[model samples]
Target chain A: MIKYRQELSFKEALTVILYTLLFNTVIAIVLTYFLKPFWENFVFSQCIGILICLCMLMIFRFITTENPLLWLLTILSGLLVGSAGGFILGAFLTEKNPLVYIRQYHEFIRIMSLGLIFGTIITYFFLSRVRISQAEDRIQEEKIKRLTSEKKTVESHLKFLQAQIEPHFLFNTLSNILGLLDTDLTKAKLMLTDFTHYLRLSLAKTRESTTTLSQEIDMIKAYIEIFKARMGERLKYKFEIQDHIGELPFPPMIIQPLVENAIKHGIEPKVEGGEIIISAKKDQDFLRICITDTGLGFIEQNNNGIGLTNIRERLNSLYDDKANFEVMENVPCGTTVKIEVPIVTD
Target chain B: MSQIKAIIADDEKELRTYLKAQLADVWNDLIICGEAKNGPEALNLVDTYQPDIAFLDIRMPGFSGMEVAEKVADRCRIVFVTAHDQYAIKAFENEAVDYILKPVTRDRLKITVTRLKEQIEVSSVPPSDLPAIIERLMAELKANQKTDYLQWIRVSSRDGIRLIPTDEISYFKASDKYTLVVTGDGESLIKKPIKELYRELNPDVFWQIHRGTLVNVNFIDKVSRSLSGRLVLKLKSPPETLTVSRTYKHLFKQM
Candidate 1:
């Protein structure tokens, strides 16, 4: 069974009727002057032709679904049926037997041939017009889809750039190093060493698709050390990881941004800075990494921050449904973010 | 001439010490009277030492540097110290206000000191229009910050989390380590500190009546004075009376 491309509406049917009437009136005027038949008889015959053709088209539409073959059959049958009905009805209205035109074979053939030619031209015009519109609609839909996908790519790229280097963190750490140089020489050396390690790891890892879990944890340790010096005595941290889990391959920069969020939104804002705990362990077929902070409890402002959203997008693209991210309020105070991804051993 | 006294206020101890060392190298006669690690300490240092100059970092705990400046603009000549704040730097430049960038070098400190000394010598009489300029800068900064005050506060109840709209809250009272969010329904405890909540709340709607209490102005029913002439507030909901501290009693002067 063939399917119909589109259903006809009442407005389209009305437009077709109006066009047919206009075309018939033009043909009737020319025929009246050339054939020398009465103008009234010509108009009367054309009206009968229009009525018969509309009735036949309506019956065909009700019985069969619309398709190219159906349309062709309707148009060809309408031409033959309408011309025969018009000739018989016109002869009977002029007080003659309806069979008089059928008896003149030459006149009957000429009138039927004219009807076929005119019907084919009109049908081709309407069909081509509908096809062009359908093609334009398809193109428009494809354009919108392409634009939306392009926009998504650009937005994610911009987010990646923002996640790479935070200007405030860079400048503040530099200022801390500058200050430490004059007061504590050995401490300054330690900070410089850790800062170098952090910059090298972050810059290098961002270029690669994945890294061992140990490397990401090393970068987080370096980050916490820099903050430890800057926030001296106020900031504390602990890392707990199961043995043999550090060597597993994981997506790079996933856990680091969450740590940054905890510091930026939770710890740094509080009067008494708090501790951050990073723990990783394997559970069944997945690796669970949790970062917990003891600072101000979860606030709505953190929800809109780019850090959390960026991490969510990265996880979705990399692991799809195999990864899970969750945020929960700690029991006493602060927030804990958990990430669980499938552990692939290869 | 008497020795010029100065105070340095920054959250980081290293920045404070570094700035002090740079000042000592440039201006020998200047005395470093005090150092503050946060905003409240900075204000306290200014009040006690009566410093001639104050170097206030823009971002600090308890209150921001701009907030501290708003309180002590008249007590000392203000020189803002910041790491990198684009909007604030632009505002400072436009107003011709004195400011210094962090990781202080000797050259920048020398310039700031020279400028401050001349200003102090020229205006030893009274406070100038610096306060007005500071106010404008603060307003601009707040506008740029797009500070949308807390509309809904999430609190834990007996069963689960409860989100209460700010309009429904009557007041917030500080307890031991948590704050009590009192409403018409009852009170729920939150882990957020009163001081931090004060900074997040809209100042016009929630007035800090005491160090430990913040009363929503819309919920205030009556204002009366005690026998000792201390101000007291009567709230409509929960129908409780709150005492106003000496520092914040001026907020109810009109009533």
Candidate 2:
């Protein structure tokens, strides 16, 4: 019943039948040389053979079988019916008994059997190939659908992480300016201008995902400059950078968060205040950066913050498994935070 | 004009000093009775000094600004100092609960100061509305503060398990099955894979400049483009320059 349904349209089927007729006609002409008696009637006998084959093909449309035994049975039955039709048609055209005509043209019968066997096997091979390809297409579509949904989930999670960063630094600077507004308006104005420049740089940095090392250092300097104006004698920082490392690309906000952490945990707790030393160096294949502070050493109780986790997650996403971050105690009494990223030249 | 005693409560020392200065400028007769760096300290100062006005930062270390406001509701007129934008502030404006944004602009502070003067001169704060206003602001503040991110990394060392801060890492290199955790003091080997560590590290600090290397971009000092169109990166680290391959060269073109 399945095979009875039209797989090809009327036009397509016609074209296939025409090509089959042409192919058989050429095969019939080539066989005439081997059979001397049928040479004069070769075209006529070949037409009869082709006509019988077409009839057998039409009958195949009514049957469908996946089992190999049933497929073999179908092929045998088609060959029997086609050869028998050829014998009867040949006898009528030659005006002789069907048995005599078959005996006289027995070689032609052999050629018809060979053609039927090859045609049946070739059709089955093509049909199975189509079925396999169709199944593969379904699987591919399902995989794409799953991947699209997964991508959406990851995108939303990323957006949530991005939304958490508030402008707390801006407000803090503003509060500092307010204090200076009464005691010294001139210093307050200067602080305000510095704050504005910092704000502009921070905003611009946020717009991009990556920035050059020099730009980040400048941003850090601007940040430290604001802190100096506010803290005055309380904060001291030193930057020891090796030659020609600024042009390398880096992510923004990394240095600022570390600096803030050092100030908040490492230095602020000590009444006497402390200094921060930031340095960078190259060690074989890595670019090493460290932030050292002269304040209270590592505290077990206050060990975590958002900035550190964010750095970890970002490194994982950007570098896969190539970056490292570490924190340790500085000599004597302070905290030192170090980071090592692969030396990427671009 | 009668002097009005006030207390400024904020976690940041700089902020406390700044707010006091701003208050003096806006209301010359206002006298700063005390200052507290945390919410609990603010409450204790209020109890001890019994100031007429309290400027409470919405967020603080001990009992948050809202909790302190609730406790001191009966004794003083409250002015909330907040850093959040929009929704909560709309409620403050609607209910006539005086609030000021950070960096207290002169113009905005002037308005709040004038309103407070009129309210104190007219009568004490109506006790009935104080609790409801504090409750609404408290809920909003709680909602706003829920956003958080990770901040620490636990690294194993010969000195036992050390909780290393993420920012302390200089660079990470491949070491067989593990990654080398290079710090200022020394290096430790962590079992975490390079790709996995990269995902966890902050992208801003660590950059993968090569297939096997992650350079701390903070230490990068210069980039040199040779005549043959190849790029090399120099870092603040000891005399070393990294070769930038064709794939990563785009990072320096924009600079």
Candidate 3:
């Protein structure tokens, strides 16, 4: 019996079942005759044969059909054809006791009634199994939908976090340019062009998700340049990315926030300037990005704002907590933002 | 030729004062026709003063120095003044009449006035001719600059040219005859002639800081001027001090 929709075969399954039943019936009759040569000459034999064939056909139809009305019609046809064949065969094959073979009419009628009842019950079982299978499919679909939605939300946040960086940088650079006008025009003019170049870059990358890590690092470098241009020599940054991890895929704008956090809270707040260190490497099958600043170490009060919260939420949404992102002190110096995720590939 | 009387156009009151003082200090003969705090004021000043020289700031709250320059057209020869040196440098590179960097360095402004004197002395050309000259200068600079502020170079080894954005490059090294572009993680060796690249690069960004070498100024970690007056540039990648060749040594002091 085909329980699930996937197992459902229309006309083809029906023909295979009927052929198997017909072969089985022929074998039964041949064995009965060869063993007792009586069924070939018997008047009741034809009636018995017709009854057996009808029962098998109804069961086959019931197992295959899902439509309840079609099942009932098929089962009823089985009974009618079985009885009509029995009566007609009895009349043609009987010699002396034709009425006697036909008189076993009650047995033939009983077979038809039983066939209808058994066929309906069998079909009911298959339908229930079919329903169970469908429920399982629905559950699997929901799981997939949930996972996809989670990925989308996380990605959107990652992109948001990344996008947030450029604007903040733009505004800050603009402020620097503005500040320069009152004191130093030449430097401001240079920074303005640098800032413009940075902005044009951010605009160009509006479509992609995972830019090459090298490209991203360059952008960060550009951003740092703007600060350097403004601060003169007040800020310094270093890259310690492992050589092997250079070609790895990473979320866009992933490292930018940590850099900004270092700048906004770490370096900018202090006098005499500070240094920012960025490093990336593969540790235990994961790509780990670490951003450390010489600014004052992590203070709970300053970082509780929506930025970290948003980053955390985005991380959760993307990797389902598979990625590890944390903010901790770099011991004697300052804050370090470490982001660890599976090494993704393009 | 008539005297090139000029108005000082700046949004900041102090810079305006500085321009007036500096202009007067440098060229004692330059007539200070007037000064305006905004573009409209500058325009009105240009109209009333009919000054031959107008010192304008590139960025004003409402209108830019260029916009004001367009308006003054033939009335006065204009010089843009802004604190940002690169833009001003680019303007001059573009063949702009002249521009002064902000803080209005006394010596630079003095040079500006001398240029103004020449423009005023030779100022018989029509204003219609001025815009065209400016446009031609801009085109010439654009075509002449080899690096169009390239963010990436998409060059292909397989296809003969792969375009890699300038921003994608982490650092560049001069490899004998060709420049080796250490791209993010995936590096590529580009066949750029070092000397030609130096001539074509934006000095403020891609500096041909070293002989046979060009470095993205964005990637420079520390730059120091040596005792011999050569500039040494340190980058994050090479972890070494790259000395600015004597030929290109003059550039480091500007930043």
Q: Top TM-score: which candidate number?
A: 1
Kindly give the stretch of ten consecutive residues in candidate 3 chain B with the minimal lDDT sum.
Answer: B159-168
lDDT of each: 0.77, 0.68, 0.61
For residues B1-255, write the lDDT of model 1, one tens digit per residue.
Answer: 577898999888888888888888999889999999888899999999998888899888778899999888877889999888899999999988889987777888889888878877887622678789899999989898845887667777553454455766899999999999998657889999999989988899999988999999988877766545667787777778898999998887776
Listed per model in order, the count of residue pairs whose N, CA or C atoms clash below 3 Å is 0, 58, 32
Model 3, B1-255: lDDT tens digits are 445576877654545665676666788877788877666777888777677677787655345566677776666576777665354466576564677666556777667767666655654543557766655544554465443443334344542333344543455677876777764335677777766555654556676655666777766766765434556676655455677777877776677
Q: Each candidate's root-mean-square deviation in Å?
A: 17.3, 18.1, 25.9
> Where does candidate 3 stray beyond 4 Å?
A1-169, A178-186, A316-321, B1-255
lDDT of 2 by residue, B1-255 (tens): 467888998766667777776777888888899998777789889999888889998766556677899888877889989766566677677777888988777788899899888887887554566777777777766676532222345576654446665555566778798787665446778787778767766676777876666767876766766434567676654435667778777767787
Candidate topping lDDT: 1
Name the top DockQ candidate.
2
The true-versus-predicted C-alpha distance at residue A131 of model 2, in Å, is 16
Name the TM-score of chain A in model 3. 0.51
Q: Kindly indicate the candidate among 2 and 3 with the higher lDDT.
A: 2
**What TM-score does candidate 2 reach?**
0.50
- Order of candidate numbers by DockQ, starting with the best: 2, 1, 3
> What local lDDT score does residue A53 receive in model 3, on the 0 to 100 scale?
52
- Chain A of candidate 2 compared with the true chain A, TM-score: 0.51
